[model samples]
Target: MDEEVIARYLARRDAIDQSVDLVVLMGSAVLESVEVAAEAHRTYAAPILISGGIGHSTHYLEGAVRRRDCRSRWIGRSRTSFAIC
Candidate 1:
């Protein structure tokens, strides 16, 4: 996971409130990225929308698998508001 990217995203999200009703994140790493984003969104009170489809080949497959794994881990956690797709 890229902490820098996550931190930047969090900082940006923190700059707004209610202004954003939903946030959509793409990419296989979305699961982890969303987790970090969700934490930041908690402070601003925003809902999240996670999106990722099966990959085209092996590389994509790997990403999808990792994302799925992360998603499973996030399943039972309670937070401000979020969703996985």
Candidate 2:
């Protein structure tokens, strides 16, 4: 890729970061995502949503967050509790 093109892409990414309403963490960055969500919650009081099952690391991440008493409701997969009313 050209240097100018890469720079443009990075600039666009920064723009998106500035305008995003919610941040989701997944894949290999789950741990980092947890910390970001928690801190963002403290600073902005914005809701954070986390979902997984893409790989084996999801379970470990979920456990870590639970151990820390992270306040979040689990949705999707086997954690959901919704009725089609």
Candidate 3:
């Protein structure tokens, strides 16, 4: 793994303004999305918008989110309110 890239990615919020409206999570980022989005909801109190299909991690993500006490609700336009996609 690229430590530099991971460091920069993890530290990305430091450069962004704290005032955010919403967060969108997509693609094959199962656990990462859960972690980030859950943290964002806890920290920012913003709603999460997760979008994606059944990638390899889909079932794992669903199970992970549920295990974390996070719930996934179906939203409009084929989107979801929680971080499982």
Tell me the lDDT of model 2 at 56: 60
In order, the Cα lDDT scores of the candidates are 0.54, 0.50, 0.63
Q: How do the residues 1-85 of candidate 1 rate in per-residue lDDT, one tens digit apiece? A: 9999987876463345246566666544335665666775676566767555545443553455456664564456543222444
Runs off by more than 4 Å, candidate 2? 1-20, 27-30, 54-85
RMSD of 1: 8.3
Local error of candidate 1 at residue 59 (angstroms): 5.1
lDDT of 3 by residue, 1-85 (tens): 9999997886475545567798776655346656777787777788878667766776775676667665644333242335343
The number of the candidate with the highest TM-score is: 3
Model 3 earns a TM-score of: 0.47
* TM-score for candidate 1: 0.39
Q: Order of all candidates by TM-score, from best down to worst? A: 3, 1, 2
lDDT at residue 32 of model 2 (Cα atoms): 55
Highest-scoring model, lDDT: 3
Which one wins by TM-score: 1 or 2? 1
Task: Return the candidate ranking by lDDT, descending.
Answer: 3, 1, 2
* Candidate with the larger TM-score of 1 and 3: 3
Clashes of 1: 0
lDDT of 2 by residue, 1-85 (tens): 6999985774352223344466654434235545555676666556766555446664665575566555344445343221111
1 or 2, greater by lDDT = 1
| Residue pairs with backbone overlap in model 2 | none
Candidate 1: misplaced stretches above 4 Å? 1-14, 30-32, 56-85
